[model samples]
Target chain A: MSELWAASALSVRIAAVATLVTVLFGVPLAWAMARRKFPGRGILEAIILMPVVLPPTVVGYALLMLFGANGWIGRYLGGYSIAFRLEGAVLAAVVVALPMLYLPAKAGFAAVERELEDVATLMGANRWQTFWHVSVPLARRGLLSGIVLAFARALGEFGATVMVFGWQPGRVTLPISVYAQFEQGDLNTALPTVLVMAIAALGLVLVYNALASQRD
Target chain B: MKHALIRLVVLSAVLLGVPTARADSIRVGAAVSLKEAFGEIATLYKADTGETVEFVFGSSGQVAAQIKSGAPMDAFVSAAKKQFDDLVKDGLLDVETRHLVAGNELVLIVPAAAVKGGAVGGFDDLKKDAVAKIAVGEPKTVPAGQYAAQTLKALKLDDAVKGKIVFGANVRQVLAYVERGEVQAGIVYRTDAKESGDKVTIVATADAATHEAIIYPAAVLSKTEHGDAAGHFLDYLMSEKAVAVMRAKGFSIPTDPAPAAPAKPATP
Candidate 1:
């Protein structure tokens, strides 16, 4: 029973870290995508959407190649022993979860009326001030929704995390733990972990739907 | 869209139907290490006896767990004894049907590019700062990991080398790490090191005295509906015919107190 909670708790921690990291990077990227018309916007969008299209294992292996001890970046950082540890798992989760947060964030930012930003700018406000005071306030609902979606996606991400982390118990999170327990035929241990994930996932969806309905 | 959907449905149905048509087949769960070797034998057995045998292969821990959870398997061939003992405790194995069929030995392995000074010699050199990482199986679930842990503990080097340990999911995965040069060294079965051909070099033979005996055991499950067929399969494994296949794959014949394997030329 404690094992199940420990796994889920680690999953929650991963999702939280992924959500935080995504929003830190994603919102700005989304706003840039929404507001700026660049020469390679389509290519940029395609690159951002790559994780969504690729199999989770492919993403995981890519993460492994990038963050693994002998990986390109990992080689430079080998002195630190970055890959296959819990930190690598978090990085993998964030990579997989980025698109979920980015799509909704871009949509939310795009839906913000250009006139409001223009008016704020006309009042001598700078770009940053206009964004915070005018654009962000109007797109708050979309930002909130995207955070929920990102959290959900991160919670459910398995393949990439497992491929990189290799199911190091008490370190990697819920899904891999359930898989390990299931493969070991410890049903008494696995079932409760699965049930907890199910409930948490369900709770997030329900809350997201309720908030979306209220916003509507 | 509808035509594509119909094609998908038909494809899925055909896939599902093929396995169900062979309902009388005995599903035998064996270790991943035995996949290529046993797959060859199973094909021969089917042709010779006209009895279909289907095999599902993975880590011994995984196979044992699957059998315990009522995975509809008729028999189990495990790479380690602990899993078999667990099944016996669960009363899932037929008491009279059990036998030790094959044996494996642990060896240190390194990438072909790395072996120097006539192999690693012993565990002392493994702790050199130049040795950045050392791969072993996950100690909890893999037999190789258990043996590696036992060896390290016996040498009192477990604590000294704790920080350098990077776990592979199984013996094969450990071999993969060494083959790719992802780690400085790894521990895997002698057969794995041999079968890897030129990809990896055997570094040293881990002494059997350092760890528990590594034995492969086979048994028919008590729940097997086709008990007669299962018994015949077990008998066949012990027969000279199958023993030759096992031996050719670097497995030794099991004995009361397994003899020390003779040192041999490393796989070229």
Candidate 2:
């Protein structure tokens, strides 16, 4: 029972940190994808969606190259010695879950009625005010779905986290610990870990479905 | 007539090249520590025999599972005796063709800065709060894990170190844990610790008698259609050239007494 709490707490931490990072990058990207009409919009969308299609290992290695101790970003951050620990796990999770957050936020942004923004603008609301006050409230449903889905996606991420963090228990998130257990053939120990993850996944899906309903 | 003869020669060359190209490409499941060394061997093998060797370098347990579950493999080189023995028991390996191709030593290593070049210390320090985490291989599948567990039990430190012990999926992972400074110390094969270079610190060597002798075995799978080719590869793995490569990679020569029955009694 204590072990279950420990594992669940770890999972929740990973999901929360990943969610926070995703929102930091996701909202702006979603806005751009929604409001900007650029020449390479199709290519940008494809690049953003690449994680959904690319092998998780490839994404992991890319993350490793970008954030490994000797990696470019990693070295800069290594002044603080930050990669391949809990922070690296969160970063890997964020990269994979970013698209899940971005696509839905973009859709939600798009779904905001143009007339509401027009009315806000005519009422002396500036662009930023119209966005924060008008646009966000109108499309809250899609944004909520995106956040839930993003958290769920981050929670289940195994490959990228494993390759980046290399399964440092207690420091790495839960998916890695599950994989290490599986590799060790302690399926008995692993069963609880799997159950916890599954329930979390199911909870996220339920939340997404509820928010999606609100959107409809 | 001349043009038709030229076409015939070109067609014959293409047909022969196609089969030889396919035949030359052979896949071998190698232990993780051998990744770079085997890559070099593969190049040599290609140069000498025109055979291109592809290696899937990972934990021997993982490679063995993959092979047992029908991964297309011609040969398997494992870091432990049990994996090969189990493969033989599974009827996947040709029983008569197995060989003890190499041996490795498990060592207790710490960050170099932690211990001032001391000839490896005793386990007494391991229990101290100063030692926050100790990395070790998972005992179920990784040979290094089994050896480390056995050594711990032999020294009666298993219970003492239980809380501070962090399990790695393989010996390499154990090294990574220590190298990344996530763990204060770790147990890995001497080869693996060496592979970490200055990233890790080696505190001491585990007495060879403390646990079972670490013998690595290699064998050709019975299901291989290229049995002759695999047999040749196994021969190379046992040859002087291969021994030199293994030695350079930190595989010890088995000079100790025979491996005891594994720590836990065999399941039978």
Candidate 3:
């Protein structure tokens, strides 16, 4: 039972950190794609959205090769091994959850009325000021729902996390814990961990649905 | 929409029915560690008999669990005796058909770069702060990991290296971790370590007395529909041709007489 709690807490921690990262980068990228016109825009958008269509295992394997100890980026970050650690699991979740957040956030940024932003700019507000004061407030509801969906998806991540982190018990999240339990032939333990994850995911979706309906 | 749905259902039905339509094949569940050897043996069996032998490879414990859950397997080749014995006790396997196939040795490995000139002594060196992480398969579910744990405990290094251990799903993953230099060292089968080419070098071989014998056993499942075909495959697995393949892959073919033990089935 305590093991389950530890796993649940670890799951929440990884998902929360992943959701924060998704918002930090995803919102800005989605904003640029939505409001700006540039060469290679389609290609950039396709690249960002690739994770949504690609199998999670492929994404996991690619991340492993990119961030593994001898990996291109990892080799330079010497002494700070990311693979087989909690940070790797968090990174896997962020990569897997990025598209879920970005797609909806992109649509929200596109739906924001251009007139409101124009009015803000006309009133002497800088572009950055306009973005925060007018654009973001209007798109808050969609972005919030996107965050929730990304959090739920990150919490349920398995293939990529396992591929990158290899199911270290102390650092393992809920889905990996469930898989480990199943592999160890303890379905009794796996079922409850699965239930806890399912209920938490259901609750997150419910909150998102509420926020989405309230937006109307 | 309804017409498309009907077409989709028919398409899926035909796709799912294709495998069962060809009933001449036999499905064998084997440990992932036996993949290279069994793959060659499978090819040889096909060439000689013109019969198809499909394989499902995974950790021995997982394969055992699948067999217990009534997986469509005609034969099971496991890397550990416990899983095979458990199945035999459960009456899921034909006890009379069980035979020792091969054995393996466990060894400690380090990345080639880490071993500059001298090897890192033995189990005690694994405790040095410089050796941050050590990869092993999940001990409870993988036979190789079980052997590693047993060896560690025997050497009294289990407590010393507790926190530094990172578990993989199977032996191959452990080798990958070492090959990629993710961990300073790892414990895996001698065969696996040998196959890792220039990426890793053996530091020490674990004493066989430290752990249960690393044995491979093969048997026919009681629920097999194709009994004669399954029996023939079992015989083929013990044939000289198969033994040669196993030997080439570094498996030590057992030459000892079968042990006499209580043959009572589990009272489930």
CAPRI band for model 2: acceptable
lDDT of candidate 2 at residue B163, scale 0 to 100: 72
In terms of TM-score, the best-performing candidate is 3
Each model's TM-score for chain A is 0.94, 0.91, 0.95
Question: Candidate 1, residues B95-177: lDDT per residue as tens digits?
Answer: 57776778889888888866664335567777777776788887666788889889888878787777778777677888887
**Highest lDDT, which number?**
3
> Over the stretch B56-159, how does candidate 2's per-residue lDDT look in tens digits?
77778888888888998888988887777778778788755666667778888876655664423766677776666788877767788889989988888888
Pick the winner on TM-score between candidates 1 and 2.
Answer: 1
Order of quality (lDDT):
3, 1, 2
For each candidate, the alpha-carbon lDDT, in order, equals 0.80, 0.77, 0.86
> Candidate 1 or 2, higher lDDT?
1
DockQ versus reference, model 3: 0.70
DockQ of 2: 0.28
TM-score on 0 to 1 scale for chain A of candidate 2: 0.91
TM-score of each: 0.80, 0.75, 0.93
User: Which pairs of residues have clashing backbones in candidate 3?
Assistant: none
